[model samples]
Target chain A: DAGVTQSPTHLIKTRGQQVTLRCSPKSGHDTVSWYQQALGQGPQFIFQYYEEEERQRGNFPDRFSGHQFPNYSSELNVNALLLGDSALYLCASRLVGASTYNEQFFGPGTRLTVL
Target chain B: SQQGEEDPQALSIQEGENATMNCSYKTSINNLQWYRQNSGRGLVHLILIRSNEREKHSGRLRVTLDTSKKSSSLLITASRAADTASYFCATGGTGKLIFGQGTTLQVKP
Candidate 1:
Protein backbone atom coordinates (compact mmCIF):
# COMPACT_ATOMS: atom_id res chain seq x y z
CA ASP A 1 0.00 0.00 0.00
CA ALA A 2 1.11 3.54 -0.70
CA GLY A 3 2.02 5.83 2.14
CA VAL A 4 1.11 9.48 2.35
CA THR A 5 2.27 11.44 -0.71
CA GLN A 6 2.85 15.17 -1.24
CA SER A 7 3.29 17.12 -4.43
CA PRO A 8 5.91 19.61 -5.65
CA THR A 9 8.81 18.39 -3.57
CA HIS A 10 9.92 22.01 -3.29
CA LEU A 11 8.59 25.51 -3.90
CA ILE A 12 9.88 29.07 -3.95
CA LYS A 13 7.79 32.14 -3.32
CA THR A 14 8.19 35.74 -2.32
CA ARG A 15 6.77 37.72 0.53
CA GLY A 16 3.08 38.67 0.09
CA GLN A 17 2.64 35.87 -2.43
CA GLN A 18 0.47 32.78 -1.88
CA VAL A 19 1.24 29.15 -2.35
CA THR A 20 -0.65 25.87 -2.15
CA LEU A 21 0.74 22.46 -1.25
CA ARG A 22 -1.04 19.18 -1.83
CA CYS A 23 -1.17 15.84 -0.09
CA SER A 24 -2.69 12.43 -0.66
CA PRO A 25 -3.18 10.39 2.47
CA LYS A 26 -2.28 6.78 2.85
CA SER A 27 -4.76 4.24 1.65
CA GLY A 28 -7.55 3.43 4.11
CA HIS A 29 -6.94 6.68 5.95
CA ASP A 30 -9.50 9.48 6.17
CA THR A 31 -7.95 12.15 8.35
CA VAL A 32 -5.31 14.64 7.18
CA SER A 33 -3.28 17.10 9.18
CA TRP A 34 -0.76 19.76 8.17
CA TYR A 35 2.38 20.86 9.96
CA GLN A 36 5.20 23.36 9.52
CA GLN A 37 8.76 22.52 10.47
CA ALA A 38 11.08 25.46 10.60
CA LEU A 39 14.81 25.09 10.51
CA GLY A 40 16.20 23.56 13.70
CA GLN A 41 12.74 23.14 15.18
CA GLY A 42 10.08 20.50 15.48
CA PRO A 43 6.91 20.53 13.45
CA GLN A 44 4.05 22.74 14.57
CA PHE A 45 0.53 21.59 13.88
CA ILE A 46 -1.42 23.73 11.40
CA PHE A 47 -4.83 22.07 11.21
CA GLN A 48 -6.61 18.79 10.78
CA TYR A 49 -9.32 17.79 8.35
CA TYR A 50 -11.81 15.00 8.80
CA GLU A 51 -14.69 14.10 6.54
CA GLU A 52 -14.13 17.14 4.33
CA GLU A 53 -14.38 19.44 7.34
CA GLU A 54 -11.87 20.96 9.67
CA ARG A 55 -11.99 19.11 12.95
CA GLN A 56 -9.18 20.82 14.83
CA ARG A 57 -6.78 23.73 14.39
CA GLY A 58 -3.63 24.94 15.98
CA ASN A 59 -2.54 28.46 16.86
CA PHE A 60 -1.84 29.45 13.27
CA PRO A 61 -3.32 32.66 11.87
CA ASP A 62 -6.15 33.01 9.36
CA ARG A 63 -3.67 33.30 6.52
CA PHE A 64 -3.05 29.58 6.85
CA SER A 65 -6.01 27.56 5.57
CA GLY A 66 -6.62 24.03 4.40
CA HIS A 67 -9.21 21.88 2.65
CA GLN A 68 -9.91 18.19 2.49
CA PHE A 69 -11.43 16.68 -0.61
CA PRO A 70 -13.88 13.79 -0.64
CA ASN A 71 -11.09 11.39 -1.55
CA TYR A 72 -9.22 12.32 1.64
CA SER A 73 -6.61 14.36 -0.12
CA SER A 74 -5.72 17.77 1.33
CA GLU A 75 -4.35 21.16 0.34
CA LEU A 76 -2.61 23.68 2.55
CA ASN A 77 -2.71 27.28 1.38
CA VAL A 78 -0.63 30.04 2.85
CA ASN A 79 -1.54 33.57 1.79
CA ALA A 80 0.68 36.64 2.06
CA LEU A 81 3.62 34.49 2.92
CA LEU A 82 6.44 36.07 4.82
CA LEU A 83 10.14 35.23 4.82
CA GLY A 84 9.58 33.49 8.12
CA ASP A 85 7.10 31.23 6.40
CA SER A 86 9.95 29.46 4.65
CA ALA A 87 9.98 25.95 6.10
CA LEU A 88 9.14 22.35 5.42
CA TYR A 89 5.42 21.83 5.09
CA LEU A 90 4.52 18.33 6.18
CA CYS A 91 1.35 16.34 5.74
CA ALA A 92 0.41 13.49 8.04
CA SER A 93 -2.51 11.05 7.76
CA ARG A 94 -4.21 8.93 10.35
CA LEU A 95 -7.35 6.86 10.74
CA VAL A 96 -9.39 8.27 13.58
CA GLY A 97 -11.29 5.75 15.60
CA ALA A 98 -12.42 5.01 19.12
CA SER A 99 -8.79 4.65 20.13
CA THR A 100 -6.90 7.85 20.68
CA TYR A 101 -3.50 6.35 19.90
CA ASN A 102 -3.70 6.03 16.15
CA GLU A 103 -0.31 6.31 14.45
CA GLN A 104 0.28 9.12 11.95
CA PHE A 105 2.05 8.52 8.65
CA PHE A 106 3.82 11.53 7.19
CA GLY A 107 4.72 12.42 3.66
CA PRO A 108 8.10 13.55 2.36
CA GLY A 109 6.94 17.15 2.80
CA THR A 110 7.16 20.17 0.52
CA ARG A 111 10.00 22.54 1.24
CA LEU A 112 8.78 26.13 0.90
CA THR A 113 11.24 28.96 0.50
CA VAL A 114 9.96 32.48 0.89
CA LEU A 115 12.17 35.30 -0.24
CA SER B 1 3.66 27.35 22.41
CA GLN B 2 4.77 23.75 21.92
CA GLN B 3 3.73 21.28 24.58
CA GLY B 4 6.87 19.13 24.62
CA GLU B 5 10.57 19.86 25.03
CA GLU B 6 13.45 17.46 24.42
CA ASP B 7 16.75 17.80 26.17
CA PRO B 8 20.39 17.65 25.02
CA GLN B 9 19.34 19.35 21.76
CA ALA B 10 22.06 17.28 20.05
CA LEU B 11 24.09 14.16 20.83
CA SER B 12 27.04 12.44 19.19
CA ILE B 13 28.28 8.94 20.01
CA GLN B 14 30.24 6.04 18.62
CA GLU B 15 28.46 3.49 16.51
CA GLY B 16 28.50 0.73 19.09
CA GLU B 17 27.51 2.94 21.98
CA ASN B 18 24.02 3.53 23.26
CA ALA B 19 22.14 6.81 22.96
CA THR B 20 19.46 8.20 25.22
CA MET B 21 17.15 11.20 24.75
CA ASN B 22 14.69 12.70 27.19
CA CYS B 23 11.48 14.63 26.66
CA SER B 24 9.29 16.67 28.99
CA TYR B 25 5.85 17.96 28.26
CA LYS B 26 3.70 20.63 29.91
CA THR B 27 0.22 19.04 29.87
CA SER B 28 -1.54 15.77 30.41
CA ILE B 29 -1.72 13.53 27.39
CA ASN B 30 -3.40 10.28 26.42
CA ASN B 31 -0.20 9.04 24.82
CA LEU B 32 3.31 10.11 23.85
CA GLN B 33 5.00 9.13 20.58
CA TRP B 34 8.55 9.24 19.27
CA TYR B 35 9.42 9.88 15.65
CA ARG B 36 12.65 9.85 13.65
CA GLN B 37 13.46 12.14 10.74
CA ASN B 38 16.45 11.84 8.51
CA SER B 39 17.92 14.87 6.81
CA GLY B 40 15.47 16.36 4.31
CA ARG B 41 12.88 13.69 5.04
CA GLY B 42 9.56 13.30 6.78
CA LEU B 43 9.07 11.89 10.23
CA VAL B 44 8.79 8.15 10.81
CA HIS B 45 6.90 6.96 13.87
CA LEU B 46 9.02 4.94 16.25
CA ILE B 47 7.01 4.09 19.36
CA LEU B 48 4.14 5.21 21.53
CA ILE B 49 3.63 5.04 25.28
CA ARG B 50 0.28 5.56 26.90
CA SER B 51 -0.41 7.66 29.95
CA ASN B 52 -1.05 4.58 32.06
CA GLU B 53 2.04 2.77 30.84
CA ARG B 54 5.44 3.18 32.42
CA GLU B 55 7.81 1.29 30.14
CA LYS B 56 7.78 -0.30 26.72
CA HIS B 57 10.40 -1.86 24.47
CA SER B 58 10.69 -2.48 20.75
CA GLY B 59 13.78 -4.16 19.33
CA ARG B 60 16.77 -2.00 20.21
CA LEU B 61 14.53 0.85 21.32
CA ARG B 62 13.33 1.21 24.89
CA VAL B 63 10.86 3.90 25.95
CA THR B 64 9.92 4.91 29.45
CA LEU B 65 7.12 7.20 30.53
CA ASP B 66 7.01 8.82 33.94
CA THR B 67 3.64 10.49 34.11
CA SER B 68 4.22 11.82 37.58
CA LYS B 69 7.26 13.64 36.26
CA LYS B 70 5.63 14.42 32.94
CA SER B 71 8.69 13.08 31.16
CA SER B 72 9.67 10.34 28.72
CA SER B 73 12.98 8.91 27.56
CA LEU B 74 14.04 6.95 24.52
CA LEU B 75 17.02 4.62 24.57
CA ILE B 76 18.64 3.23 21.48
CA THR B 77 21.11 0.44 22.17
CA ALA B 78 24.11 -0.41 19.99
CA SER B 79 23.39 2.38 17.59
CA ARG B 80 24.66 2.45 13.99
CA ALA B 81 25.61 5.30 11.72
CA ALA B 82 22.30 4.88 9.96
CA ASP B 83 20.64 5.84 13.21
CA THR B 84 21.73 9.41 12.72
CA ALA B 85 18.63 11.58 12.62
CA SER B 86 16.53 14.07 14.55
CA TYR B 87 14.28 12.52 17.16
CA PHE B 88 11.06 14.22 18.21
CA CYS B 89 8.65 13.54 21.04
CA ALA B 90 4.98 14.28 20.53
CA THR B 91 2.16 14.33 23.06
CA GLY B 92 -1.26 13.29 21.89
CA GLY B 93 -4.37 14.68 23.51
CA THR B 94 -7.67 16.23 22.46
CA GLY B 95 -7.24 14.76 18.99
CA LYS B 96 -4.05 16.73 18.39
CA LEU B 97 -0.37 15.94 18.63
CA ILE B 98 2.14 18.55 19.77
CA PHE B 99 5.81 17.91 19.05
CA GLY B 100 9.02 18.83 20.83
CA GLN B 101 11.93 20.71 19.28
CA GLY B 102 13.67 17.36 18.68
CA THR B 103 17.08 15.91 19.56
CA THR B 104 19.63 15.52 16.82
CA LEU B 105 21.57 12.28 17.17
CA GLN B 106 24.72 11.47 15.25
CA VAL B 107 26.14 7.98 15.50
CA LYS B 108 29.68 7.93 14.19
CA PRO B 109 31.08 4.78 12.69
Candidate 2:
Protein backbone atom coordinates (compact mmCIF):
# COMPACT_ATOMS: atom_id res chain seq x y z
CA ASP A 1 0.00 0.00 0.00
CA ALA A 2 1.16 3.51 -0.69
CA GLY A 3 2.28 5.35 2.42
CA VAL A 4 1.58 8.93 3.43
CA THR A 5 2.46 11.49 0.74
CA GLN A 6 3.17 15.25 0.91
CA SER A 7 3.33 17.83 -1.83
CA PRO A 8 6.01 20.38 -2.73
CA THR A 9 9.00 18.55 -1.33
CA HIS A 10 10.80 21.91 -1.09
CA LEU A 11 9.62 25.52 -1.03
CA ILE A 12 11.04 29.00 -0.76
CA LYS A 13 9.22 32.17 0.23
CA THR A 14 9.90 35.65 1.52
CA ARG A 15 8.97 36.97 4.94
CA GLY A 16 5.33 38.07 5.30
CA GLN A 17 4.34 35.71 2.50
CA GLN A 18 1.80 32.92 2.97
CA VAL A 19 2.46 29.26 2.17
CA THR A 20 0.28 26.19 1.88
CA LEU A 21 1.52 22.62 2.16
CA ARG A 22 -0.51 19.54 1.32
CA CYS A 23 -0.57 15.98 2.62
CA SER A 24 -2.35 12.74 1.72
CA PRO A 25 -2.49 10.26 4.54
CA LYS A 26 -1.85 6.58 4.14
CA SER A 27 -4.70 4.56 2.84
CA GLY A 28 -7.20 3.39 5.47
CA HIS A 29 -6.20 6.16 7.88
CA ASP A 30 -8.43 9.00 9.03
CA THR A 31 -6.72 11.32 11.45
CA VAL A 32 -4.01 13.74 10.32
CA SER A 33 -1.57 15.83 12.34
CA TRP A 34 1.02 18.49 11.48
CA TYR A 35 4.39 19.21 13.04
CA GLN A 36 7.33 21.57 12.58
CA GLN A 37 10.94 20.51 13.02
CA ALA A 38 13.74 23.01 13.07
CA LEU A 39 17.24 22.07 12.04
CA GLY A 40 18.74 19.54 14.46
CA GLN A 41 15.64 19.51 16.68
CA GLY A 42 12.68 17.31 17.34
CA PRO A 43 9.32 17.96 15.78
CA GLN A 44 6.92 20.34 17.50
CA PHE A 45 3.27 19.60 17.17
CA ILE A 46 1.27 22.24 15.33
CA PHE A 47 -2.25 20.85 15.22
CA GLN A 48 -4.30 17.72 14.60
CA TYR A 49 -7.41 17.33 12.49
CA TYR A 50 -10.16 14.71 12.60
CA GLU A 51 -13.55 14.66 11.01
CA GLU A 52 -12.75 17.94 9.32
CA GLU A 53 -12.32 19.67 12.70
CA GLU A 54 -9.23 20.54 14.64
CA ARG A 55 -9.17 18.28 17.67
CA GLN A 56 -5.98 19.28 19.47
CA ARG A 57 -3.36 21.97 19.03
CA GLY A 58 0.12 22.78 20.26
CA ASN A 59 1.54 26.06 21.54
CA PHE A 60 2.09 27.48 18.08
CA PRO A 61 0.64 30.86 17.19
CA ASP A 62 -2.65 31.50 15.38
CA ARG A 63 -0.72 32.00 12.16
CA PHE A 64 -0.62 28.18 11.82
CA SER A 65 -3.79 26.37 10.78
CA GLY A 66 -4.78 23.13 9.03
CA HIS A 67 -7.65 21.39 7.26
CA GLN A 68 -8.55 17.71 6.84
CA PHE A 69 -10.62 16.61 3.89
CA PRO A 70 -13.07 13.73 3.66
CA ASN A 71 -10.50 11.74 1.71
CA TYR A 72 -8.17 11.98 4.68
CA SER A 73 -5.91 14.46 2.88
CA SER A 74 -4.72 17.51 4.79
CA GLU A 75 -3.38 21.01 4.18
CA LEU A 76 -1.25 23.17 6.47
CA ASN A 77 -1.38 26.94 6.04
CA VAL A 78 1.00 29.47 7.46
CA ASN A 79 0.28 33.17 7.36
CA ALA A 80 2.68 36.07 7.88
CA LEU A 81 5.59 33.71 7.83
CA LEU A 82 8.82 34.57 9.58
CA LEU A 83 12.38 33.46 9.14
CA GLY A 84 11.93 31.17 12.11
CA ASP A 85 9.37 29.31 10.03
CA SER A 86 12.18 27.95 7.88
CA ALA A 87 11.99 24.31 8.83
CA LEU A 88 10.60 20.95 7.78
CA TYR A 89 6.84 20.51 7.92
CA LEU A 90 5.85 16.96 8.72
CA CYS A 91 2.47 15.32 8.24
CA ALA A 92 1.41 12.25 10.16
CA SER A 93 -1.71 10.13 10.02
CA ARG A 94 -3.32 7.25 11.88
CA LEU A 95 -6.63 5.52 12.08
CA VAL A 96 -8.73 6.82 14.96
CA GLY A 97 -10.32 3.40 15.34
CA ALA A 98 -7.03 1.55 15.26
CA SER A 99 -6.42 1.94 18.98
CA THR A 100 -5.26 4.44 21.52
CA TYR A 101 -1.74 3.15 21.10
CA ASN A 102 -1.77 3.21 17.32
CA GLU A 103 1.38 4.59 15.73
CA GLN A 104 1.31 7.49 13.33
CA PHE A 105 2.84 7.18 9.86
CA PHE A 106 4.67 10.27 8.67
CA GLY A 107 5.18 11.71 5.24
CA PRO A 108 8.51 12.71 3.68
CA GLY A 109 7.79 16.34 4.78
CA THR A 110 8.13 19.64 3.00
CA ARG A 111 11.23 21.73 3.55
CA LEU A 112 10.25 25.41 3.80
CA THR A 113 12.86 28.09 3.42
CA VAL A 114 11.80 31.61 4.42
CA LEU A 115 14.25 34.22 3.18
CA SER B 1 7.10 23.66 25.37
CA GLN B 2 8.17 20.13 24.42
CA GLN B 3 7.18 17.35 26.80
CA GLY B 4 10.02 14.91 26.22
CA GLU B 5 13.79 15.37 26.25
CA GLU B 6 16.36 12.86 25.04
CA ASP B 7 19.79 12.43 26.56
CA PRO B 8 23.31 12.38 25.09
CA GLN B 9 22.08 14.31 22.03
CA ALA B 10 24.82 12.55 20.07
CA LEU B 11 26.52 9.17 20.15
CA SER B 12 29.20 7.40 18.15
CA ILE B 13 29.58 3.64 18.21
CA GLN B 14 31.36 0.94 16.24
CA GLU B 15 29.45 -1.52 14.16
CA GLY B 16 28.04 -4.54 16.01
CA GLU B 17 27.95 -2.56 19.23
CA ASN B 18 24.71 -1.74 21.01
CA ALA B 19 23.39 1.80 21.18
CA THR B 20 21.00 3.13 23.77
CA MET B 21 19.08 6.39 23.92
CA ASN B 22 17.07 7.69 26.85
CA CYS B 23 14.05 9.92 26.95
CA SER B 24 12.29 11.64 29.83
CA TYR B 25 8.87 13.23 29.82
CA LYS B 26 7.14 15.60 32.21
CA THR B 27 3.56 14.36 31.93
CA SER B 28 1.77 11.05 32.08
CA ILE B 29 1.27 9.24 28.83
CA ASN B 30 -0.73 6.38 27.43
CA ASN B 31 2.13 5.21 25.23
CA LEU B 32 5.66 6.02 24.12
CA GLN B 33 7.03 5.55 20.62
CA TRP B 34 10.44 5.63 18.99
CA TYR B 35 11.19 6.88 15.50
CA ARG B 36 14.28 7.15 13.29
CA GLN B 37 15.10 9.73 10.67
CA ASN B 38 17.94 9.69 8.15
CA SER B 39 19.43 12.78 6.56
CA GLY B 40 16.60 15.06 7.71
CA ARG B 41 13.98 13.03 5.89
CA GLY B 42 10.73 11.45 6.95
CA LEU B 43 10.58 9.72 10.27
CA VAL B 44 10.30 5.92 10.36
CA HIS B 45 8.38 4.37 13.22
CA LEU B 46 10.60 2.10 15.25
CA ILE B 47 8.67 0.76 18.20
CA LEU B 48 5.98 1.61 20.72
CA ILE B 49 5.60 0.67 24.36
CA ARG B 50 2.46 1.23 26.35
CA SER B 51 2.56 2.97 29.71
CA ASN B 52 1.71 -0.19 31.58
CA GLU B 53 4.25 -2.28 29.73
CA ARG B 54 7.74 -2.41 31.12
CA GLU B 55 9.59 -3.58 28.03
CA LYS B 56 9.11 -4.68 24.46
CA HIS B 57 11.33 -6.02 21.70
CA SER B 58 11.07 -5.97 17.92
CA GLY B 59 13.87 -7.44 15.86
CA ARG B 60 17.11 -5.89 17.16
CA LEU B 61 15.20 -3.06 18.79
CA ARG B 62 14.20 -3.10 22.45
CA VAL B 63 12.18 -0.47 24.26
CA THR B 64 11.69 0.03 27.98
CA LEU B 65 9.22 2.34 29.63
CA ASP B 66 8.95 3.33 33.29
CA THR B 67 5.77 5.18 34.08
CA SER B 68 6.81 5.99 37.62
CA LYS B 69 9.94 7.80 36.47
CA LYS B 70 8.33 9.05 33.31
CA SER B 71 11.28 7.88 31.26
CA SER B 72 11.95 5.50 28.40
CA SER B 73 14.95 4.02 26.63
CA LEU B 74 15.53 2.51 23.22
CA LEU B 75 18.21 -0.08 22.66
CA ILE B 76 19.48 -1.13 19.28
CA THR B 77 21.54 -4.30 19.23
CA ALA B 78 24.38 -5.09 16.82
CA SER B 79 24.06 -1.81 15.04
CA ARG B 80 25.26 -1.31 11.48
CA ALA B 81 26.37 1.67 9.41
CA ALA B 82 22.89 1.97 7.93
CA ASP B 83 21.57 2.40 11.46
CA THR B 84 23.16 5.82 11.66
CA ALA B 85 20.30 8.24 12.09
CA SER B 86 18.51 10.51 14.54
CA TYR B 87 16.22 8.79 17.01
CA PHE B 88 13.29 10.49 18.70
CA CYS B 89 10.92 9.52 21.49
CA ALA B 90 7.34 10.73 21.47
CA THR B 91 4.70 10.58 24.17
CA GLY B 92 1.02 10.13 23.51
CA GLY B 93 -1.84 10.60 25.92
CA THR B 94 -4.17 12.83 24.01
CA GLY B 95 -4.72 12.92 20.26
CA LYS B 96 -1.49 14.79 19.64
CA LEU B 97 1.97 13.32 20.17
CA ILE B 98 4.72 15.27 21.93
CA PHE B 99 8.28 14.66 20.75
CA GLY B 100 11.70 14.93 22.33
CA GLN B 101 14.74 16.69 20.92
CA GLY B 102 16.14 13.28 19.75
CA THR B 103 19.56 11.61 19.73
CA THR B 104 21.84 11.58 16.72
CA LEU B 105 23.60 8.23 16.46
CA GLN B 106 26.55 7.44 14.21
CA VAL B 107 27.51 3.82 13.81
CA LYS B 108 30.96 3.50 12.27
CA PRO B 109 32.04 0.52 10.26
In terms of TM-score, the best-performing candidate is: 1
DockQ of model 2, rounded to 2 decimals:
0.76
DockQ per candidate: 0.71, 0.76
The residue ranges of model 1 lying beyond 4 angstroms of the native Cα positions read: A98-100
TM-score of chain A of 2: 0.98
lDDT of each: 0.93, 0.93
Query: After aligning candidate 2 to the native by TM-score, how far in Å is the CA of B90 from where it should be?
Result: 0.6
Listed per candidate, the RMSD to the true structure in angstroms reads 1.0, 1.1
Candidate 1 scores a C-alpha RMSD against the true structure in Å of 1.0
TM-score of 2: 0.97
